[model samples]
Target: MQRDKLITAEVADLLRPWFSDVTVGAQPVIGDAPAVLEQPDHAVTLTWRVGSDDPHDIVIMGPRTQARYHLERPGRDCLQLRFRPGRAADFLGRPLRDLADRAVDAADLGSKSLTAVVQTIADGGALAASQSHAARLRSLAEAIPVAPPTHTDRAALHRRIVAEATALLSIGDGPTHEPVHRVARRLSVSERHLRTVFADRVGLTPSRFVRIDRVRAVLARIQQKLPEVSSRAGYYDQSHMTAEFRNVMGTTPDAFARRRWPTIEACTAGNG
Candidate 1:
């Protein structure tokens, strides 16, 4: 498969108010994989399954919060627009919470125009065989009506806060855990309000999201053959770590390490 990661330089300043870097990726074919990485919340993915002539081309794969997932490789080539957390709701015109942990066609969500645009990208990824998918995607993002924030819009502010909350919750080798109340106070919202907004816009509640992200961190370490152990990821002990993996990833760490899972990547959650 031909793989390319393109910069969103043209729209970076324009999208900063509401998104992270508008990175674009294009590929000629998707190879089969047995497992998909359990990533932190992903932005909305706009996919164009190449070789498929269906007008409804753009498929939105929502964010996930898990240790791993069984993989299902796509049959065709496509370009993807990974929309950052807290921002997809505006482009989608709906609460992202309702669409969590699933892939829905743009047409199904009343995203007819986007579906059409994705078809264009699919054509771009396939027919524009001459043009790079990244180039095609950059041109495509320019066509969307994602207006930059003009002032301190409350909704815009809310999106920013919720996005930050997701980042803060993606704890690393820090204190293992921080009180949600502290973060809520820092964001100037009540804990309950933060939970509501986070779930509605970011897919998972703060605590659950934190737990899962921490597990992902540990999994990454084990996969890398690093000296780090699960307990270093804030688990109580080796047994606690093993049990967490069995319950969350459905396997033990030793079993998980033998498999291949690319970082910042995805696949179906299959048995390792």
Candidate 2:
């Protein structure tokens, strides 16, 4: 079947220093077949979409693994934003570990500030709920809540560390197996500090995040039919890749390799 692309706008330039991308647009989706909910593999996402029951606004999707779940409503438009790893700290105003694998109702990220706007939509005021989804999100960016510099040296250091760590982990297209010690040494911080910042900021132990990234990376390569997916993508070998893949993805690499993912492919940008 031919692939369909959801419209994606790079609103990253608009929300700097906190959000990496804001994806606003809807795509045509056919009804979906039941499928395993792929583990939490994408970047931290803020999503608003039309649903079977009603509209879902201010849903915060964190990072972690899970079992079966359904996709978003078919034949409906979805709006979403993805935060750069470790960058969600200020906007979310909390540790990410608390929300992993859950799409909990969001209160932060300037959601409270948009209450009047959303309430108006709910009450059939200025805009319908459908129009409100994207507009409210854009309002979120325009709000651009900047905190007064009340943080101590320690807080600023932590942000810098997490930001650098996020960049380090993101290098080379996928996750790295480089020793945490080496990474810490390169970043000029101790391993203990590195792990703490990762947990507090990006919401995973450094090792666990790396493993998830490796598995997700290899799967992306497999999906694209890229060569040497295992080795080139940083797994020690095929066995290593398969074990990690099955652990996070709940399916074997070969199973994913041979299968077509029309539903998964339909809306791509928000996955980060």
For model 2, the stretches where C-alpha displacement exceeds 4 angstroms are 1-11, 24-39, 50-56, 66-72, 107-137, 146-150, 174-177, 224-227, 260-272
lDDT of 2: 0.57
Taking the tens digit of each residue's C-alpha lDDT, what string does model 2 give over 80-182? 5667677666566666766666666543434443343344435443234464444454445455554313357876788778767766664256535566778
Q: Which candidate's lDDT is highest?
A: 1
How many backbone overlaps does candidate 1 show? 9
User: What is the per-residue lDDT of model 1 for residues 222-272, given as tens digits with 9 covering 90 to 100?
Assistant: 754433565567766777777766666666677667554433344432111
lDDT agreement with native, every candidate: 0.59, 0.57
Candidate RMSDs in order: 6.0, 6.5
**CA deviation > 4 Å runs, candidate 1:** 1-5, 8-43, 51-53, 66-75, 112-116, 119-127, 146-152, 172-177, 224-227, 260-272
Tell me each candidate's TM-score.
Answer: 0.72, 0.72
